[model samples]
Target: MTKHERGALSANAPKSGEADLETRLSRLRAALDGRAPRLDAPFPAVTLIFSVSDGAARAVTAQGSGATVDAAWEVAVTDLHRKMGRRKLRGRFLRLDWVEKAETWTWALLRKRLREVKRNYSRRGIALEKGFTHLFLEQELNGNAMLYGGNQISHCVVNEKNFLIYAQQKYGSGITVDFADDREVHVFDTAGLFCGEDGVLHELYGAGRNAGRRKIDPLDVDTLRGIIGDASDFLAHQVGADGRFIYGYHPCFDRQIPAYNALRHASTTYSMLEAWELTREPGLLAAIERALEYLCRQFIRTAGDDMAFVVDTGDEIKLGANATAILAMSKYASLMGTDRYAGIMENLACGILHMQAEDGSFTHVLTWPDLAVKERFRIVYYEGEAAFALMRLYSLSKDERWIAAVEKAFGHFIEKDYWKHHDHWLSYCTNELTLYRPEMRYFRFGIRNFEGFLDFVLQRITTFPTLLELMMAGRKMLDRLKAMPEGAELLAGVDEAKFEQALHFRASYLLNGHFWPEYAMFCRNPDRILGSFFIRHHAFRVRIDDVEHYLSGLVAYADYIEAVAGSSDGAVRA
Candidate 1:
């Protein structure tokens, strides 16, 4: 059974404000049933928050640490009562969080955390620069925390800085403790038992949607469209007046990434086009065109050989940039039925062809204008993107050279067994290739790309957006193969049902990375961050390319759902 099919979404998964109060409280009660601190031992800190749906008190939170569970519970309740200023409470969300484990801070652990914090927070300018809330503890739930609000936070990943200002209200402020200096200072490992929309005094998960702890419903087409709409809206909002996306934001500190990539610009535009084709949302087309115009007007440069390369900001050119440039415009032409960019797309294709060598390998990087090979190779994505760009051109212009170029690249790919990388672009191009020449070789290559890979896709935690893109493209090819008598022979070794299961599960799993309001609200700029996709492990970064891959993948999955599972004709449902 699917995770959702087996009641995972109700109690086991986190979805903000959706589950019944009884169900949410049951999860909390189940956790607090037997576990308690040892007698005379340092008890876990108990925190209770009451969010009033009515009455004067909107929400109240109180945290207490003591030598016993009851003591800690009483201290917390006392503080909560003081804040509520009344005994009777009604119509509120509840959340309870406590330290599930506490360990003395070690040098190794501190170093690891410092590295993580530096990786994400170090890039900021004035945002995190002046906070003295360091050299302290943070709270990270073991994937069990649900509602992120009601003055609570729990993530399958980790949330830091809870203890940064634990004892102080401001930076540079010192806490004059009346204790011995030789005492052991311990860091905590915390857990959250968030209540559902239940009643008073019970811990609860807040009513925050996508609050990092809520369960995600199994995706039908409508669900996919909702997330896709959210993400696309985020992209639309990200565009600046200069026709460029403001790159992306780290969001943790509301820091703009500062660095920009032309390649990602074109690729992001391509993703917006994918959404435009699928959604045709009113404001989306303008955003897509403005982004495209930025790419063409600012980045594209024609070489002395009459080939066009998307020059990187530093007077350098990358093969991937040119490919995605073609992809963006080619997709635009295909969707809008316009050839305004045909000449430009042709030159871009020629530039990719120019970079190709006799063995079908392309130089991945070069200096613009001079067209000098700067680097022979960078990433396999470049090769796959090149091939895909060619196929896109072939579909539009019916040029045989584009076909032959992809064929040659495929020859090189097969010779080297490129499928081992499990790159999504390769799968995408391979799917596009087989459409024209239903060659078994291309079909086999697509299979090999995902062969023995679903287990990884299922078990992995990080929401690698490309996996669904790979699977969706490959599944279409697989479906085509299933229809062919000769193709049916190839299926003997594959588990069709397992493949189907993985596709459904992976599509659902990626939702965890989406910027639901519950989780997004914790960031500095919730409005901007909301409706985007994030890599939780990467300090909850919201990058344009990340959103692009996510948006493109969801758009594809939504399309597939419409084909097989029927359709839901609506915008985003509540």
Candidate 2:
């Protein structure tokens, strides 16, 4: 029988809320007396409701009722998916069913049922326990916890006994699961005012309709709040005076980076930015200042060169991913209208410029004991990124030398030698290149093709039948940026289509491909990953179980953190 059926029956014939183990057992016997004939008749499907309202509650089905909770669950959950349509999540169960058979209605059986549900969701890349505040510690339950305010968990998946104890310790009462109806289950606390599924907390404290318009999922937001709160707690608990953050616990094994300082700065800065945009919150400016102070101190003793790489220990640089971080610092500097970072910016800019070869191409790494030219294969991808950075700096400083340097470097991208290397899929590079040098007509040609690619992605999203089609659309977009025009003002009097195409292409590729993934992961593990990662690298694959698909998210988050904290963009501050 399905858990829903059990819950329905249980609700009709329930145990005591406050009765001790023995009394509850006695009450169970008494309640079953009238229902004995049904119990002896057949093992009817029972519906279960795991409600969280007032002090650990439960509603079991009538002893021998013939309710099919499984069928009820399938119908209800399927309906939710159909109703939700495009926003439907992969593994989220709109309804639940019970699996374990309790020889008798006991709390232990309920606990076992919860674990089974948790496992089912976990396989779909959902971490049910991670976002649950009660599972973590008692600290989160008191006085306005952020997770409680805007947190969510898909469902419970773990040891039910442990979960109960955790809840009891935090709330001073055990959890109660109630079957509200054939379609819904509710989790309750002491007052029963707040419910895990439908109590008023979400409507009261969560993001409202504006959030839905912004494409923020209510469930997703709640889950993120938990992850973010947990991360914040972890940092507060582990960070030393030196600002080094430690993660010597489950899931990660032993992988750690010296990034807490940068991460905290980035999250705070991003929050402030969001607050200013979302609310007229005036305190964010002060928060940014405070964040900047911490960020500046972290880098005061470190050399400017090391600041660009993800894990630079005095020498060598990891350029491609680090470029984004550098770009962030540059954007922040321009936004803040402050040149306090001028000294650091100058050093990194010079270092990057020095790395460019006479041929105009650049490598992923420029410094090493053995000057292996093989290690310096013309990495067109990062070369284009660095060029974009140079262009941004020129825009900011209006330095003639900077313009001359970019023009020369851009020239090499179009040469017959370079053009042949990219084939037909080089347009992605030019989309970014156009931003730096829009004056040249030849570059405008490349821009046109890139714009075409953007239209392609849009069409695919609309017409394509599968996720593979979407990915192919992305490939088509990236493969067309082979070469660009020589001058800087290529788009000076161009039609809207050209610019619009470029913008759409970037919006799809960068925002969907990079930004979404990072945000999803940050929502899942906010402490280590941070939300800026989501902004920097924002896209997730069709099903989240594909963890390897997280490279872009990881790199993007790293770059975002660097951008927020560092004085300037890395070796190339653009």
lDDT of each: 0.67, 0.32
Candidate 1 clashes: the total is 14
What are the models' TM-scores?
Answer: 0.74, 0.41
Off by over 4 Å in 1: 1-47, 50-167, 170-211, 304-306, 567-574
Give the per-residue lDDT digits (tens) of candidate 1, residues 103-156: 454434433444443222211101110111122213112111111111222222
Please provide, for model 2 over 115-147, each residue's C-alpha lDDT reduced to its tens digit, 9 standing for 90 to 100.
454211211110112112222211111111211
Give the range where candidate 1 is weakest over 10 consecutive residues by summed lDDT: 123-132
Against the hidden true structure, what lDDT does model 2 obtain? 0.32
Q: What TM value does model 2 have?
A: 0.41
Cα lDDT, model 2, residue 113 = 51
